[model samples]
Target: MTVAQLSPQSQVAALPQTWDLERRHQSMRRLVDVVQQLSLARSLEAIMDIVRVAARELTGADGATFVLRDRDQCYYAEEYAIQPLWKGQRFPLTACVSGWAMMSRQAAVIPDVFDDPRVPADAYRPTFVKSMAMVPIRTEAPIGAIGTYWAVHHEPGQDELTLLQALANTTSVAMENVRVWSELEDRVDQRTRELDAANRELESFSYSISHDLRAPLRAIQGFCQIYLEDHGDTVPVEGRPILETVVSNTERMSALIEDLLRFSKLSRQPLERHTVSLDDLVRRIVSAQRAAAEPGREIDVAVGPLGQCEGDSSLLEQVLVNLISNAFKFTRGRTPARIEIGRRSDGDEPVWFVRDNGAGFDMRYAGRLFGVFQRLHSAEAFEGTGVGLSIVQRIVQRHGGQIRAESAPGEGATFSFTLGQGS
Candidate 1:
């Protein structure tokens, strides 16, 4: 019932002090136990049960009910009366006392239900409820209400009202926590399903490349080689050049497909991390590059002490191979191409770098450097599939690292990266 509707005599009628000091002390101890249990409750149903029992015990009431707001209805979701009273009942927001308490955002203490005009008399006719006290679960915007009832006309005092309000406040927090945790679990499940679907699609694509694409490429390359060797003299000299061009293009296509497959595989490959000597890995790549260089080409490579890092050894080796090879490819015209491999600290983490005197790119287009099949120079000037940097970036990212480059047109470039503490 609204406070304004109460008669002057009933409003100030003092409630009898039935609870002694010892009874109040026992109530306080029970309230503390209920609060502790509320924190471990995982569901709204469980929280409601705890609140229902706690409210009855703390206020020495004959019955207690937990009411939740459901749109335009007040739902008696749970009840703990000595004899059942509206255990699974629902009423219109305007017709129920619980709804009125929530709508007014205040507690209702009715000493005599039959004397109050706001009481729905017919609903209590079959039950023994003669009085009730209801406080909204939340103060500012009530989501629900906690109610206590008596079988006889009994006035509830200020202490009993205060105890019920504290229990309602704790119930609100527990319910909100359960809702937020449920939402987070649902989001995690959705993301996991999405990742599973994407992986299946990728596996299908990879299978198609390995079988369908490779079959046609292998046939073309084999036929071209047979034709050039078996019947070279039968064709006109001018026409022979066209046949050679076709063979070269087919080889380049095969190389491009292989690089694409490697790039795709990186996403699914699990990292096998361990301590790797960066200095040793760089030296091995440089040795391989020098052995494959043209006879007259001269290149000066300086390998310094690169501190060890924890990462997948094979993947780290591939990163060094790609960066060093790019340096060699871009510095084709330099009489004595200079390349340096070293590492230095950046206060928090060690930053390893590959510096080269080569054909550096414009800083404006550096954003596109790590994209697959993106190239700054034409094929005629420098031949490449342009998938190397993309692969390097993915490997570094998988290791929880960051990579960036500094460069300008005509000036040389430096690529640096940091791999965080190992997982």
Candidate 2:
């Protein structure tokens, strides 16, 4: 009110300065909004367009252009203006202000385009641009520049220069984000393609093993049986033992192929999840193993309360079979084999375990435990194809779970697994 009481000339003189400050504040607010929107730009072209338009509007420029550094050339890739400007044009770095800003790594503010020796006179003679400012997109290792033009001879204020630099900085970050996102997408696509090709090859191999390979094996087994039945008396005693050995080896090979097929199928099979009573499943597996065990061998197996878990029933059954069978197999020399199956709550997930007083392995070889055909014991000590644990690991992974073994040599082995969720 006291200022208003003064002369009208005083108030009028102050109005232009006040309006200039308000305009700059408004531009700063708009720049903030532009930067936020630019962050979400997914492509380079979109980012360029956003930067060009924001630069023109925020600085009250007659036109705006985004010039990208392409090798030794400055490419005018995009433009936003009331009149036609250099859009889709390329020039040498020596002849363009945008290029000059990028080369110097600083902002270029020219009040008179013709008076500046850096300005290319012939190139600007036909344009409405009498003054312009160019700012490097990035201060360190500048990638490009943002250029703004005016129709009349004008000097860019500090506020205008600052706002343009801010826009240029934001544009650099947006461009970088777009590049990183594109690279990530490409990598993901490449990996997906590789996985698809690998799966196809595995299917072909599985087919060969099931049909082509099995045919020859069956033929050998059949011919051996024919010789035993038809020419048993004609064959010599030593020759008969050799033929029996051949038959036994063929049977073992058949078992190996079957297990191989199962292991391969796990990679392709989709999971079917349901709540399964592990208590009942473990009991059935233990009963079967006991039946197949050596006659008169008493194995004390304690079945504890095994809580329910959500997983593929058939796959989980296979996991229990492999683990429990290993327990029984390794406990061969013990007078009374001790095996315990139980469950406990660990946080939100249920941890189920199978413990057995068996011939445990050294912890040093644990890294190779889940590999295909990696066995801790020799064939003479424990007979297996060494594919069981690998299959178990794959199944557990498919069910969004984990399986790990704890054991030391000459002590005992305990396998603990958690079924987090069904995949």
Candidate 3:
């Protein structure tokens, strides 16, 4: 990281046998360090800060100017100098040496600024600059220039010119990288805003639908209940079955509406994270299921070493309740309906699962398992609102996790989930 050292008398030293090689090596090291810094530069200000200092140190220049093209003008944006030159000034592109370098797409080497007609003599009269070398920032369709100045008449060597151009080339690439990243950030921000607006609209629509639909459904249920209670004997024997059918359908419809509302509400629910013991949770749910089981319906449930996780206790409990309940329902009529709750490792992820040896579904329809109101088994065979898995999936996803199912007809089904970061 050593910088090239020049004699106090001259900024650009002659090729002396004593220290020519050593100085060149130091300059190369400095260039490498500057290139590394430019790679991480995310803005124009950062690029200019690195380039301005490196330009003076690399060439032993008395001063340096970082010029940027502003349409047909050359802007003296930044500078590192012993004396002020043009720190914040603008001039016509055709009137400045840096502009000429950009326009010609080559380095401009002037040994005497006063003698050169292209050099603005009026500007240099006030500064200590007697000679200068300017290189375009980009060779093809140049965007700017880097200029190094000397107090005395001195001509730059091929090595100095080459190093300066290399810096400019790297600067071009760095600017392009900054532009690409800025555009990407803008696009991501725009998409995020759009998604937020859509989610808000959907929440409003779902709530409206829930309220509007539930009122009529409650009315129907109330009228059916009154008819069954007060007018049961008045109805003929054949009409009694029809009346019962109407009541059953109304109850099923109410269950479906409740489940639908629950599924919709889950999307907007804020998760409250807490440490949860899967073993305790599963045992409690299984105990309740056992207590609720019909008399003489022998059921055997095994609780395995289910681990713990960080998640919403209420939402996660709902997940387990729905999964375990489905296992209990599907395993009905078995000699001893068996259900197992356990944990397993899939690669680096820990998966928790609820398994049943009851009636499993075909694997081909597995994709539809988490969809609302989608069911493989009919309501008559296995009664359900069919929104359980969808709600389970929403909760798991809110915990930054995923849920999946595997099953084969008459072989049983296993539902597994992972609570990624929460785990």
Candidate 4:
């Protein structure tokens, strides 16, 4: 063949093939961009907006509709088109091409709407759509459909159909992700509301106990003191012991009320955190305890390098006071009460501990150790309001820390704790 004649024939054949390849390549590139956008979409509305524009551009279609299956009806929720086809409209599942695609769980290609038995002729007669293609959003169980329309009689190429289906599949995942996120947000909101309500109730209860209950308790204690000081000698010998019992109980009641008030205040107070030399704090508390100790009592205290920690100084001091005070109170009968205060090495975190060779408790009761008003020993064995350990626990938790106790009967007790970053 002559060069000129061969060139004409070759050019004619190569031109269409090259054009088709370029079109497919552009469609795929656009699909990639659409997929990226869909992945970030947090709402169904966002997904709809993305798919509407991409569907028409990827297929070179004149119009595209984002359809959702509303029960047995196909709802045209959104659209992007040269001319409006169905922006807000509904049709029976059997009567609409989009609905048919979702119901059958496959893509439907129609070269001519009038020639297809599935498409309602009356519906297409007033519209510009002649040829159309619809793909289900999901393959196994379809939720919706993506429909592309052409004004002229045309059959979509296999490449275009594949790209459209790919877009549809991605849309399904995006929609599911949006649903899951929305549900999670709702659960968090509900939990927050519940916590707020519970906190408000606790505050009200604390206030009532502080005022209403304390006034009467104060009156009882005051009267008992007056009776003891003014009329003590007049009472019969046998009645004197009963009168003393009333005075003793009033003092105990006052102490319990004070402990309760302190416990309540701990929850409302905000933490004033800073770097604190725990060694100094522990020593100061122990010094005060020693000064208040019985004149002849002997206490052997072993203080180690407690080091520095991030925490509220006053609150941390209270924790140490409660633990050390409990040690002194429990080891009353010991010849020389032994108490140890120090920090031990822990992986990536600091662990502080208080140990005492005191009248220790059983390990089985350890779970109840931090609960309010939970005492392992009888009132005669240990004189305490039982709110001290509970207060210690609350302070540790507020500082982003955890407190645990370990002990057995006759063995020393150890209270160990860890503080998080804020602590």
Candidate 5:
């Protein structure tokens, strides 16, 4: 006889009713409510609860279960209204009809579960599900199976199978959305920690730079002064020049220390931006540099009618000083050399350029030009701490600006950099 020919009552003395249309309608209504609730739920636990409740009612099966297929095993992921079909249980993929549904990626309605050789008799006997509808709950792949079952034999017709499949579809989509949300949260948390670590490393680097650079400068200055004071008269003429060299080296070191401190402080402080004239700032910087220059050196300062910019005056002054000093120092060899400090409008804002017929840098070394302790010329050729351009670069960067240099071995350099456009 076919599986259906065997009466459900005859096959199992304790079989459930299969053709109760009124009972089936009530079960399906409860299922529709469950699917709607699952759709609105955000939490995984809530979604699973809806799935289980719907499964229990729709199948009219005494027990229902949700299984999570992990690797090759199907474990009781969650349970529902009925005495569970082996509640909190697990079964191997090679052993049961539910596992077969998971592996095959399809639904199975077994009118007689044990009648099919695929069903594990021992696993089924515990919470007798003689009639069964197993639906795979899937998102990316086969994740698990949701099954509605009977405690005794009852043929689950097509209507019950359809309801079971619908519930599984709802669970699959909801689970996938929740999994994606969890992964995104993890990625954001990891990125935040990485950024915090980077900031701490930068702070440690700054502290080390300060301690290592200034400690030796103090000793060089102290020893140079002591030698000149104690043994000035007895020292030979050749020795005196060497002593003078010591004093010069110490002074240069002191200047370098001051420049480095200034650069470091700039990075930590907040900018005090206000409206100021670019043209006026340049003129003042030029005058001060000329006064500090060897008594007779000329520098021509030319710029268009002043344009107003919003920025920190003190930092801007330092930027102008560094750029102008570099211009003056480089052009020292030319008998009547000229240094021009100028500014012009680029689109809506002013762009500044310092052009000089003085020492120019090689283009290949341009990459290192704006790094602290990065020097293009040797101390023998030009006297500087090499930290000035670095300061200039930082100040420009903090102001959301950009800088560039154009120079060749013999050709004079032109440093062009732009600040934000003035309103």
Candidate 6:
């Protein structure tokens, strides 16, 4: 880009033919300082100081003043203070040379304020102020003006005009930065508010699950128990199966309620990762199942040595208990049923699995396996609330891990899960 293509306000001033080259070079150095200050400083106030100091030193004027346009045209705002001259002075929008440049949208350079027809008479009565130079801050319409006033009558040379215009151009860009920064801060604050609202909606959903689920479950359990106690003897033998059905439905409902509560509690609770012995939790659950089996039924249990993992001991125990219980129920009809609990570490955190030789599931229905209340078998063929693997999925996800299922009809079922690993 050529210097001629620069902003009109940045053009070199029309200088007198007799001006010396040394004075002009000094003016160029001061203009360099103005551009560097605008680029380096962070805040608006520091930038205004750079402009004030640069403008005064470059021209050797008695006093320089800079003003900016405000939201309302009632006042052209004071932008900077340079002392010991016009540090606290202000020029009104309607009655000063500064006002003329802003209103006309042009640079008004007055070599002698007293002889200039454009100068306001009322703006100079009380002081010895004589000659002055005023220039409009152009480029995207003049927002304000910059000028210097001398105490004695004198004319401003071309080099002095050139220096003042350069200072004015730099001030325009610095002002624009302040405006953009204000807009960015406002946008950030708006996004913060939106995130806060979404979190509150999630909290409300959790509350509904806690209070709404438990009420209906209590009613189903109470009425089923009442029917078995009060009407079992009087009911006909054919109606006995109806009472059994009610009892089964209530049991499934109770299990569903418990699963919902556990899912809601996982995130808010602190994790207690300990080196756990899965075999011990497995043994306890199996022993209880063996004691609860029906007449003449036997399910053999085989458990391998489980490698350790970092997880809450109580929670991991529950995961094993659910998977094993599902295995036992699904394979009860087999003549010689078998259940195995085993693990493989393989350079990662241990992954344990439960395999059962019983009625296996179709692979096409695999995606529905871990969803709550999803069942592949009927109540008569195998009894379950269908929440076992769903609980396993939640526990695994809490530990930053995953769970999977593999099975086909009549072959058997295997449920496995891993925790805390990428290997």
C-alpha lDDT values of all predictions:
0.88, 0.89, 0.89, 0.88, 0.78, 0.73
Mark the regions of model 6 whose C-alpha exceeds 4 Å error after superposition: 1-224, 227-233, 236-244, 347-349
Which one wins on TM-score? Answer: 3
lDDT of 2 at 130: 91
C-alpha RMSD of each candidate structure in angstroms: 8.6, 5.4, 4.9, 6.0, 11.8, 10.6
User: Candidate 1 lDDT, tens digit per residue, 116-200?
Assistant: 8778988888888999999999988899999999999899988899889999999999999999988988999999999888976
What lDDT does candidate 4 reach at residue 403?
93
lDDT by residue (tens digit), candidate 2, 30-62: 999999999999999899878988998988999
Task: Compose the digit string of candidate 6's lDDT tens values, residues 1-423.
Answer: 544675765544423222456678778977886788887766667766776667667877767666665532424333322334333455565666777777876667776676777776555655556777777666457777677767777678788877887778777777777667767877888887886577456645755775687787677778867877898798789887877777777677666667666665665667788788676778888998888778788778898987567788888887887888888888888877899999876464667789999899999999999897788999778877677777788888888888888999998999878886631
Q: Which stretches of candidate 3 lie over 4 Å from their true place?
A: 1-41, 53-63, 80-88, 125-130, 150-154
Q: On residues 157-272, what C-alpha lDDT tens digit does candidate 5 reach at each position?
A: 77777788878887888888778877888898999899868855665576567668777867877787787899888889889888788888778877876776677677678998
Report RMSD for candidate 2: 5.4
Worst 10 residues of 1 by lDDT: 10-19
On residues 1-423, what C-alpha lDDT tens digit does candidate 4 reach at each position? 433465777978777777888888888889999999999999999999999999999999999999998999999999998888878998899888887888788899999999999899998898899999999999987999999999999899898899999999999999999999999989999998999789778866876776677778778878877887899888889988887788788788778878888888887888898999998888888999899888898899999998898889999889889988888788788778898888886777888888888888999878889988899999998888889999999988988988998887887788898777654
Q: Quote model 3's TM-score.
A: 0.85
Better of 1 and 3 by TM-score: 3
After superposition, the stretches of candidate 1 with alpha carbons farther than 4 Å from their true spots are 1-67, 70-100, 103-105, 110-133, 138-142, 146-192, 199-203
lDDT of 4 at 220: 80
* TM, every model: 0.69, 0.72, 0.85, 0.74, 0.56, 0.51
Clashing pairs in 2: none
Worst ten-residue run, lDDT, model 3? 9-18
